[model samples]
Target chain A: MEPVSEVSGRAIPFGRKNIDTDIIIPAHWLKTISREGLGRGAFQALREDPANIFDQEEFKGAPILIAGDNFGCGSSREHAAWALLDMGIKAVIAPSFSDIFSGNAFKNGILTVVLPQEQVDRLLEVARTDPINIDLTTQTVTTPFQDRFAFEIDPFRKHCLLNGLDEVGLTLSRDEAIAGYETMQAAQMPWFAKGTGLAA
Target chain B: MASRPRTLYEKIWDAHVVEDRDDGTSILYIDRHLVHEVTSPQAFEALRLSGRKVRRPELTLAVPDHNLPTTPRLDSAGHRLPIADPESAQQLAALERNAPEFGIRYISATDAQQGIVHVVGPEQAFSLPGATIVCGDSHTACHGGIGALAFGIGTSEVEHVLATQTLLLKQSKTMEIVVDGDLTPGVTPKDLILHIIGVIGTAGGTGHVIEYRGKVFEEMSIEGRLTVCNMSIEGGARAGLIAPDEKTFAYLKGRPYAPKGSDWDEALAWWKTLHSDKGATFDKSVRINAADIQPTVTWGTSPEDVVPIGGVVPAPESFSDPSKQDAARASLDYMGLEPGQKLAEVEVQNIFIGSCTNSRIEDLRAAAAVLKGRKKANNVKWAIVVPGSGLVKRQAEEEGLDKIFIEAGLEWREPGCSACLGMNPDKVPAGERCVSTSNRNFVGRQGPGSRTHLVSPAMAAAAAVTGHLTDVRELME
Candidate 1:
């Protein structure tokens, strides 16, 4: 994971709600077993439509995506987050995200920006003309036309993403606490200390 | 100050509250954690990296399903397809490697009990009433059929549960969806849920925990309840639950995770009380007549764009909203179906009766009964049934259900999430239409440009026999 301080990129706005993980990366893509080349398959069906946002020239190489409410709603395919990352999408602005998808995005260094629907609509409009700017430190999304909106994130998730930390990182950060708990548990439940026996 | 009376949700929630934070969320102690090969790899890796042992090995279980091959075949190394999906294989291997390392019980691919985590969990009684079960799969809500508060978690959360046996969460508002009265004949639980999705639309239950109540749900078998709860995610719910009753206790009594001997009596007594009080209030309530439900099949890319069997596909002009009209037109065009055409007249190239949604033994039996002596349509390229678990497969085979399917020209294969999505080789070709027993009918869900009509197993079987989307009730007549 890497901290995304500030990012400037093209905007690909998908104006649909409940864009599930199955649509992002179809289950067929799961057969290969490797995360490599997933971006090519990302939005495969969407790309089939010549008028799709992903196929539009303006959105090509877009490192940021603006989506509608309840984005990434289906299967917990971490590949959805991975594919978005591989497609060079560093930030996603949406009204809300599925909890599992949001967690996957945060862990993979993808910044999921939660904005009000009005702000998202405004950003989608601004994205038509100029590159969008997302500042993690300021907690705001700014456009060249001088429009800006602040977004909210879970404080703990914000901390982790800002520090490029994952769950493993969070757990490691509490090494002393875990070690202390282990020692205390060993004393309180002696069976746990016996390495090879059942606890109860 | 007035003390608030606790609802069932509140009681179970309070019992599991291990820690409360300033942010107004609680860390809930998970009573049981079920894992599958697909999502457990990364969690195991995280545990290994941290050098932490599983807190309660006895409380955890694992199985492999999503990527297992429906047909038993040898890979280049002579290993099975369970070891085929390199990623899934790696995950399965990691689970096998880590389970013993962590002293957790894991059912490998070859194990007769190994299958979809949801299917295996209930069969093994790991998903008991009044328990807070967490799995790394969205359909973990399937366990909620027995009055358990089960929900899906991410890999990190999976590791959290494995290491600490607790989940950090904010409380969700409860929504009661009551379907009262007797379901009309031929209106199965699958149809009832599909109709619910149609009425409420996909995003209606967003951010809510839904509890299905009333006569219809109460009378449903444990399997039927599971089918309904399994699709909770499809309706945008965090999870779906039904209160525990005699049926629930009967289902768990002799299973692996149920309490033994004297403990069983105490467990049943506790489980019986795991229900809402008479005056329990909910944030929202919606009631629907069970008799109004009919055999439902999706007509468009989304599950909400569905109509009852024999109903006509809606035209764009039928929609008042311009945006909705455009979506409707596009979906109809994409599906290669004409607006106003009868749904039963639509041809189906394939018929799939599997996936977590409708792959249980009861589902198979329903389809088998319909296809018993009938031959499949000549134009139907494929009709397949993939059971949810090894146990289901074995049960079906023991009853010669496989022979019935094969005799009817339907393929009987091993248990896995086959054809539900275009995950494996069982996908319908691009531009083909299918009648599926799975949950979703999203664009290209079965394959690229493949239109899917979601239905019950019996409906799918009837469609396969007719080469079109026909009502299964008609076949019975």
Candidate 2:
């Protein structure tokens, strides 16, 4: 995964509400053995319509998206995040996100920028004709028209996103403490580990 | 230690925190990690790409349920399982290959222990009280009924747990719901939860972990408690739990994965103390009169679009909130329904009784009780009952529940998430309406353009018998 500092590009203005994981990447596409080439499956349901914005030429390869409230609302399938990433979407500006989808996005270097509904609506409007810019350093989303909206992110999530630190990297950062705890755990509750005693 | 009365959620959570990072999140160790076919392929592929082996294979369990064919092809004896859908076949094969390749325990489609991940976890005692369990399925909250700190996770988190049996998470706020008084004779946990979701709306429990308290849950059997917790996700809750009691311990007494002898005694002692203290505080609290609940049914697409069987569907225009009205109207359009229609008057073309939500022995018995000598209506073209697990199917067969269903004109299916999401062949046709005993009622969830009315198993059984959404109480007595 790559570090996510800033993303600037034309934004896809698909602000439909309650866009669930099933809609993001429907269950049928989840059968493949490999994760590659999932961008084709992303928004397959919406893209079926001839007038769908996802299939519109102007929004092709947009790096940012403006989505409605309760985005990524259903299922815990990480393929939803993977599909977004594969479609080259680096940032999703929404009113709110399903917690599972937000976590998956962060892990995959896709920035989930939560703003107030009014701000999100504004971005969706701006995204129709102009490009949008997001700066992780300043936690702000800007448009070509000079409209600027600031947002807040959890410091830990920001740290990981900026550093390109996955869970493996995070655990490795505190190896000594983890190792010490494992040792203590092994001694105190021998039966607790059960068959997982190979390593902590 | 200072004397502090802690909620059950707090006690389990506090004990698992390996480190409080002083940030918004904490690093907590996971005791058990369950995975399914759909979400884990990429995680395993990622591991292969990164050259990382599973750090604790024994702590992980894999099963095939979603996308599994309920009625597998049969030869002379046993399921030959010539899966019709290529994608569904591939997922099962992938799970079979990945589980063994990674050295994790795999229960395949043919395995007797195979079932929905949520059902198999507790039945096998793999999900224990006071343990933090995570699965890549949203219904993982089902385990919290046994007092485990369990919730759904994404595939990336699944991979993270595979690499290191731990999670870095910001603790969710605690919400408690207390339901008192006796339930109506025909009312069930499914009805109770549907009624609760109706009151709270879909996003009501967002950002919170809910603990179900009071006499209603206490008197309810473990299976009923599991049904309530299973649909917590429908309310947008991170997880739902009931405090472990004698019933909880009794259910786990001699299961294969549970501790034994002196270890069991020690585990029991600790689990006994897992209940909330006398006056534990919570971020949110709700109290409901259990007697007020009726056999509930979802009228629209979302789980929150629900009404009692006796009530009429409210007009979207009646709601003051603009968004609520818009959502309701859209749902009504998709469901081919109009406001002010009595719920019992809505006709159903299909009736399905299965899913992680309500496919236990009790659910089967309840539905069976309603349909023992009754035959389904002529207009109802299809009715199927898929058990949650192979063990459940076998037990039902032994008790003649399968005969009761078959005798009543409903097809008895093998264990799997058959028609719940239509990943398999057991789906209602497009534009058809179905009364289902599943957790979700998302539009086109059963099939493209197919309408679903969420109901309890008993209600669904009655619908199959009457060819429309009917109240079980009407048939009772």
Candidate 3:
């Protein structure tokens, strides 16, 4: 996960709420066991529209996506995040996101920035004209029009993103504590040390 | 601080606390780890890179479902699409490679018990009452029907569950959605859930764990309760749960993964206590009338945009919220239906009678009873039934349900998440409409430009014969 100090990219805005994973990547695409070539099937239906943001020349390779409230709802398909990442979406600015999708995005190194509806509306407007800036160090989203908004992130996620820490990183961060607990539990609960894998 | 007796949520919350931060969040230990093909690959790779052993591998279980193809086929290159897509194959392969390394049980596509994780978990009784269950799949909430505080987690959480058997969670408030009275004939569990989602709206239950309590839910079979809890996400609830009762205990008994002999007696004693107290306080309460709920169907984009089978589409002007009005208008236009058009009058080109939500044995039997001796409508382009699990497929075939589907001109296929996402080879083509027994009906959810009307299995069978969105109650009469 990249600590996005600042990002300036064209925005592909979707003005719909509760845009689910099914729409992001259809279940048919899930048939392929590989993550490779998934970007081709990303937004399969939306790409059918001649004026779709993905197909439009102006938004091609844009690193930012402005979505409405409750974005990335539905099945916890990591492919949805993978597809967006594959599409070069570095940051997703939305009013809100599904908790699972947001976590998936955060783990995959995509910045999911939550702003108030008003800020999202303003950003959506400015995005149509020029690029937008998101500074992770300052936790502020800025546009050329002087529109700036601050957002809050879970400190652990912030730390992880800043250090590019996956699950292993988070666990290793607490290795000493875990080892200590294991040693303590071994004395208190000897069954835990049996290595027989019995249910507690 | 005031003294208060701990609720089940609090008890579980306190029991699993590993790290408490100043920010009012505590890391809770994960008790059980359930994994699938789609999300385990990267986690395994991370473990490999960091020289980490699978911690407490005994608690972990793995299965492959999402990427497996219902139809066996060979690729153009003649390598054979083992599970349909190369990506799904890679995911399954990665899981296969990692399971042995980690000492976890792996149920492959060829495994007799290979099916959706949610279905497989409950069928095997691996998800017990009062346990915390985490899976890579969102429908993990289905296990909550067993009174477990189950919810979906990400790959990172999957890793967390594997490494530490714990998760960091902000506890959710509890809400009781009580549906009174018995369901009328032809009204199935799917109808009850659709009615709940329709009444509560999609966002009504956001940030809460819903306890579905009522005569209707109590009377429902274990499989039926599973169906209701399965779509909790559709209603925006973090999870839906039902207290364990005799029905739950009976269902869990004799399952392959369930406790055996003397252990079963002890387990039952513990399970019987997994219920909310008589005076249990909830953050919110909603009472619904079961009699008022009809065989409902979704007409618009979201699952909440539903009306009775005989009802008409709501006019955009009827919505006071401008954005909602715009959404309703867009949905109607995209669906090619006019305001006030009878929902039943809407034609359906396809009928899909399977999904994780309604593909169980009971669902198949219900649809089969409706489709018995009936041919699908000549214009109905596609009508298929995909069982939820290989077990269900086998059970249905043993009962000759597959023959009924085939004789009815509906294709009977293997089990997986088939038409539920336009995944696999089953999909409603562009510009087509379908009556699906699946959960969501988001625009293009079934296929590109393919409109979906969510209904019960029997209802889908009825529509398959009529080639329009019709109620099965009339046929039952």
Candidate 4:
């Protein structure tokens, strides 16, 4: 994971509410065994029209995306996050995000900023003509016009994005704790692992 | 001091905590991990790159469902047929190789137990009460029906579980969605859940763990409860749970993975304590009258775009929110529907009665009952019934449900999530409408440019016979 601190770039204004994972990357693109090269398939359905915002020259390789409320509202596909990352999206600003999508984005080093609807609307308006800035350190999103909005994020997520912490390695460091729990679990709840055995 | 009365979610979360970090995140142990082909190949590749082995292989089960075709797998001469899609074939081949290489249990696509991960988990008793189950598929919440703490994770988290069997997590707020009155006739669990999502909106349950309670759920069958819990994700919740009871016990008893004899008795004692205590409070609560729910179906792309079968298409202007109004208009355009049109008058070209949401044996029986002695309407171009698993298909055949479906002019196909996501070749053609028993009705969910209307198996069968979104009650009449 690449460490992310401050992202300043042109932001794509895609103000569509309930923009689900299926819309981000349709199910047809999920067949590949490899995760690379998903940017070509990102938002494929909406990009069918040449005038779609994602493919526009002005927003090409935009690092920030300003979207409407309840973005990424369906599906737990990390491919949605990978697709956005592949397309050079470092941060997404929305009024709200689905729980699973927020987690996925965080795991992949993409920042999910949740502002109020009015703040998001203002950003969407400003994003059309100017660059936007996201400062994870200050926990704020700023526009070129001096518009600023503070957003809340989980503190643990903030640390991870800032440090590019590998979660599996972090959890692996707590192996002793996990083994201790297992030992106690075996004593108190033996039946829970009763049928767990080597694969036949 | 007396201990605080914890809700079911809190109890499960507390029990599963391996360590509580200073950052307010807990390392929660996962008891069971279900794997599928599409979301897992990348995770496996990462493990191989990192030289990491699966920490607890016995706790993981892998199967191929998303990209596997539901059509017959063997040729007439008994040789296996090759998957037509190259990308899909590569993914399936990866899972078949990865699972065994990691020492995990692998159910082959040709095996009797192979099915949608959500369906296979509960059927084999691999998902048990008070356990934490994680899967790469969103509908993994289906196992919550039997009182397990189950939710979906992304590929990164899948790798986390495979390496350590723990997830770094914050506790979700608890919400109780209680339904009291008896559901009206022909209003199945699917209808109830669709109506619930409609009331709550798609984001209503965000950041909350919902526990279904009251008279309605208590009397519901295990399969019915599973169907309701299955759509928790569509309603914006990570998981949905129902307290374990006699029906839950009965559903798991003597299954292949369930505990035996002394273990069963001991497990039952602990399971009986899985429910919330009297006076236990939740962060939020909703009361719904079961009778208010009708045979519901989605009228637009989003799951929250649902309307009762008796209702008419709603105008975009009818929505209170401006953004919703815009979305409604776009949905109407994509769905090729007009405002004020009768929902039942809209014809469908395809009818799909299978998914992790509604392909269990009970679902098959419900559809078969509706299709018995009735021919599919001539206008319906393709009607198919794909069972959830080979075992489910065998069970349906033993019950003569397959014959009933075949005689009704619907193709009886093999299993593996056919047409649910249109990843396989069983897609509803572009620009056509399908009444699907699957969970999502998102844009092009069945296929690019395809329109989907989510409904129950009975309602899907009703639409198949009538060639329109008719209420299942009318067919029963």
Candidate 5:
């Protein structure tokens, strides 16, 4: 994961709502254990049209995606986030997002900005012509015409985005606390910890 | 001091919290972790790179289903056959190697216990009431039917759980969906959920964990409840739960991983108190009349495009929102549906009757009942019945359901996630429509250019026999 604080780029004006993970990267592209080269499969179905927005010269490789409500609404495959990152997308501005997708994006260091529908509509409109600017420190998305819209993000997630934090390492640091909980759990609910090992 | 009235979700969540942070995130312990081939290899690789051992390998289970072919894995001499697809073979091999390397228990593809992770979890009693389960697949909410707090996670989180046996999380708001009246005879739990998604739209439950309430769910069998909760992701909910009852206990008793003897008694006492307090309030509430539900089917690419079986394809203009109207037009175009076309008249080239959603023995029985004395119509080119797990397949065979399906000209295949996604060899061909019992109807979900109409197993069987999307009730007469 890379730290992300500020991003300025032309946004792909994909205003389609409910663009699920399948639309982002189909199930066929999920065969590899590696996360590289997925940008080629990002929106593979839509890219087949040749004239799709993603393939257009102006939007290709754009670092930001401005979408409609409920983006990434199906499937828990983090390949969707990896595909976006591989496509050089640094941030996504949407009216709302599926909880799992939003969390996945955050862990992958992709900034998800949630704004009102009107603000998103305005950004989508401005996105077609001019580049947009997103400042995490200020929590605002700005346009060339002085249009500024604020967004709310969880403080912990904001801290993580500002500094690439290894969540697993952080959690592991509290090993003692976890062990204590396990001890208590074992005493209180003995059946819950029955091992699933084959030998057992 | 009296504690605040809490819902079942709160009770379960509170029980699992290891520590609360000042920034509103909690380090929550995960009780059960289920892994599959597709989204897990990368996570395991990350753990290996970090030199991390699985904190509690005994708490995890691995199975390969997403990319495993439902075709026979053995030859005439009973020798194991290689997977025809190289990528799938490699992925399954990775899981086979990684599980043992990490000290986790694995049910190999050839093992009679191997099945779709969600199906395997409940049947083996690995997903118990008051437990917190996480998986790499979205249908993990199926475990929530047993009164567990289960939801899907990304591969990053998969690695996180494997290394620490915990997740950093924020609590989701609670929503209660209540349906009281008795469901009509022909209506199934699949229809009930599909109709609920239709009423609420896909994003209606976003950011909330839904608790299904009222008499209809109480009367539904555990398998039916699993079918309903399996599609919670499609409705934009991370999880959907139903409180555990005596029926839940009966379903779990004597299962392989269930607590035995005195331990069962102790677990039962706690599980009995897993319901919401009488005065508990929810962040959101939705009420529906059970009689209003029909044998529903989706007409477009999204799950929210559902309608009663007898309804006609809707015109794009019928949607009030401009964006939704555009989406409707796009869906109609991709699905090759006309504005006024009746749903029943829409022909399907293939039919699929399996997935985590509807591959249990009861689901097979429902489909078998519909196909008992019937045959697939000539227009239906491909029809396959894939069981959820090896045990389910064996149970169906013992009950003669396999004979009914084979006699109907439907192929009775092995247990795996066949035709649900296009990762495996089983996929609905391009430009063809399929009536599937799986959850998603997104474009290219079944395959590139494939059109999927989500339905129940019985509805899928009804379509297979008639070569079109016919209502199961019509066959009941």
Candidate 6:
């Protein structure tokens, strides 16, 4: 996973609500063994409409996606995140996100910014012409037109995203605590280890 | 000032918090993790790239479900493996190769023990009260029926749990939905939850953990409760759970992985405390009357887009929001329905009675009861009955449920998540309509341009026999 900090780029002003995984990356695209080259299949059904925003000339290579309330509302497929990443999107600005989708995006270094509906609407308007800038350290998303929006992210997540601390890194950092718990478990409930494949 | 009492959601969450980071997030430990072929390959690949071993391999279970065919390919010796589609073939093969390499147990496609991750978890007693279970597939919340705090996680989170045996989570708000009074005899748990989803819009439970409460849930059978909780994700809840009660303990007792002897007593004592403290409050609560719920079915793309089985298709113009109205209009176009069309009058060409939603043995029995001596309507060109698990298949066969299904012209097949997402060969032909027991009603979820009317297994069975959406309650026993 890549560490994310400050991002500056054009934003795709696709402010649609409750856009599910089926819309993001259709199930047919999930058959591939590799996560590579999913951008072609991203929004396959919607992109069929020649007028869709994702297929427009200006939105190509955009790094931020400005979406409406409750985006990413279904499925636990990480392929949705992979598809967005493949499409060159680095951040998603929305009013809210489905928990599973946001978790997936966070792990894959795609920053998800939650703002109020009004603020997201304002950003959606701002995204049409100028670039948007996001600074994780400052917790602010700024537009070229002097529009500024402040957001809140869990401090732990912000730190992890900033430092690229994946789960393995996070756990290895706390090896002492995990080892301590396992040793205690060995004493208190030896049978717990019996059925388990853990070293007895 | 005294502190407010904690809810079951809180109690379980608090007990599992290994370390609070003081930043609105905590490292929550997971006791059990289930995985399937569709989502784990990338996670396993990530572990390989990072040179990591699964921290607690024994705590994890893997199975091939989403990409496995439901038709058994028999060798001359009668040995069977479920494989037909080549892409799905690769998915199952990769999972088989990855499990042993990572020290995790892989229940193969041919293994009679193999099933959907959610079904196999509780069947083998791997999901216990107060346990925190995570899986790469959604509907992991089905385990919540057994009183475990279970829910779906993305493959990246799956890799996180694999490498660390814990997740860093910003806790969710809690919702308590209390449904009191007895359910009318024909009102199944599927109807009740579909009713609940109708009450709460598809996004209503967003950012909350729903704790199902009141007499209705307490009296519900574990299978019924599983059917309800399995679709919790449909209403946007990360997880939905009921407090473990006598029913839960009774279901888990004597199962393969359940506690034994004095351990059983000790575990029961602990599980008894899994419910909320008296007078504990939730962040949000919705009260519902059980008697008011009817046999429910979906008419639109969203799970919340449901009405009474006898109700008419909603007119998009009635919706105040133009976007939702447009969505409804698009859905009607896709479903081949006109505004105010009677739901039961719509013809259905196919019916699929399976999925994590309502593929358990109880679900089979409910549908079989309706299909026992009835012949499927000739208009219902083809129908299929897929059990939730390999074990469920055996038990259903023992009860002659397969014979009844076959006699009704419904194909009784091997166990896998067939046609739920069309990862396998069981797909509805384009432009055709199907009454499905799956949790989703997303456009093209069954196959491209396929119209899905989500209903209970009994309702699906009814549609199979009637060739249209019909109320299972109104069908003669």
**Predicted complex 6: CAPRI docking category:** medium
* Tens digits of lDDT, candidate 3, B141-175: 78878777778877666766777666666678888
lDDT of 3 at B273: 62
TM-score of each: 0.90, 0.96, 0.90, 0.99, 0.99, 0.96
lDDT of 1 by residue, A59-129 (tens): 87799999877788877677788788878888889988876688778877888998888888888888887
| CAPRI grade, predicted model 3 | acceptable
Model 4, residue pairs in steric clash: none
lDDT by residue (B1-477, candidate 5, tens digit) is 989999999999999999999999999999999999999999999998999999999899999999988889888998889998899999999999999999989999899998999999999998899999999999999998999999999999999999999999999999999999999988999999999999888999999999999999999999999998889888899999999999999999989999888989999999999999989999999999998889999999999899999999999999899999999999999999999999999999999999999999999999999999999999999999999999999999999999999999999998898899978999998899999999999999999999999999999999999999999999996
How does each model score on lDDT? 0.80, 0.87, 0.79, 0.92, 0.93, 0.86
Model 1 steric clash pairs: none
How does model 3 fare in lDDT? 0.79
Model 4: lDDT of residue A9: 92
Off by over 4 Å in 2: A186-191, A195-200, B77-79
Worst 10 residues of 1 chain B by lDDT: B80-89
Residues B1-477 of candidate 2 have per-residue lDDT tens digits of 867889999999887778889777888888889888888888898888889888778888899888887875465677475788888888888888999999998887888899999999999888889889999988999999999988999888888888877888999989998999999898999999999988876667878899999999999999999999998888778799999999999998877788777767877888898988988899999999998998999998888888889999889989897877888898898899989999899888999999999999999999999999999999999999999999999999999999999999999988888888888888888899999999878867887778999999999999999999999998876
Candidate 1 vs. true structure, TM-score: 0.90
Docking class of 2: acceptable
DockQ of candidate 1 is: 0.28
lDDT of 3 at B259: 63
Model 1 spans > 4 angstroms off:
A4-7, A31-37, A49-52, A55-61, A136-138, A163-200, B1-3, B73-94
Ten-residue segment with the worst summed lDDT in candidate 4 chain B?
B254-263
iRMSD computed for candidate 5: 1.4
DockQ of 3: 0.35
The TM-score obtained by chain A of candidate 3 when compared with the true chain A: 0.87
Q: Ranking by TM-score, best first?
A: 5, 4, 2, 6, 1, 3
Docking class of 4: medium
| Interface RMSD score of each model | 5.4, 2.9, 4.0, 1.6, 1.4, 2.8
